[model samples]
Target: MAKETEIEEKNLLTRNEFDMLADTYQIKPPQFFWQANTYFDTPALEIKEQGAALRVRTKSNNYELTLKQPASAGLLETNQTLTEVEAKRLMEQAELPEGEVKESLHPFIGDTSMLQKLGTLETYRAQTSHETGILFLDHSVYLDTEDFELEIEGSSEEEVRKWLTSILTDHDIPARPTPNKIKRFFTRKQELAR
Candidate 1:
């Protein structure tokens, strides 16, 4: 884990310093976005209720890949358009491959009908594209309110791996390409087993 002080120092970099570092590192400026999701989140009664989603995000003329899933009810309250009551009702009726029921903290029950506006979610995307001999790779980065995503695509898996490794070194960001489980459907069975 980065030490608190280290994070603070990184966050404190002046805009000019950040821009300079980004330029030197071939990193692009951070981009921000607000996405409105309209999905029926699963109820918490099942242990394996967390599901998966696919996102194709773009900014500054660059495109990237994203994978996401529903988290806690609190997370839904902040991201979705449904009121607590509406969400609870939808969750309770949500059909899962493995059937289950929805659940929430006690406080959510009494405040079902009321709606509260959540803040606009912010995200960033970074990318690099290059070719090696006859093969080409397009790499992209994604960040939601909570996590970061890196995706690699090329003529072959090996080329994708090489492309990813090169980006890691250039940006000084430490990460490895997870086993490619990319899928088109956004469902509990299709997503990673998180």
Candidate 2:
């Protein structure tokens, strides 16, 4: 298990802008990979109400469970590596894996058994380092919907914001409001259910 404070700046990007930036940076080939993220929440969304999200991400034949909660800087992320069987059980049966993730989540969600898989989002992502920060380009698909976005992660919020402003301006990419992947997944799921 690992605990870390994540600080990042993100923006919504148009497909054209995403392609333009990628080309300019020469971001191609094996830098990009696919990952599937499965989100979990209570039937009443109690966990979301408390400003927290739980997800299991599968990438490169590895699985990891993560809990994200609001923090002063950005978000507090707690992650735990899971075996294939553990990941399957959690995603298919809503069984909380035993470890730090579950222990930390129990306080926010009283009964772990009530947690169920809400939805899944698949994304193709590429990342590179830029000026003391990491830049991420993402294209995500969920519930027949798709979006392109960019994210910059840094040690400090201010640093990330500064770099993000410059990078977007240089690339001529308009800055737009963007939610995290989980929020977008939930929104799309709701839309599809209607």
Q: Once superposed on the true structure, which residue ranges of model 2 sit more than 4 Å away at CA?
A: none
TM-score of 2: 0.97
**Tens-place lDDT digits, model 2, residues 1-194:** 99999999999999999998888778995789999999999999988889899999999999999999999989999999999999999999999988999999987988999999988899999998878989999998988889999999999989999999998999888889888888888777777778
TM-scores of the models, in the order given: 0.31, 0.97
How many residue pairs clash in each candidate at the backbone level? 2, 0
Worst 10 residues of 2 by lDDT: 184-193
For candidate 2, the lDDT comes to 0.92
Q: Which structure among the candidates has the greatest lDDT?
A: 2
> Which lDDT values do the candidates have, in the order given?
0.32, 0.92
The pairs that clash in candidate 2 are: none
lDDT of 2 at 23: 88
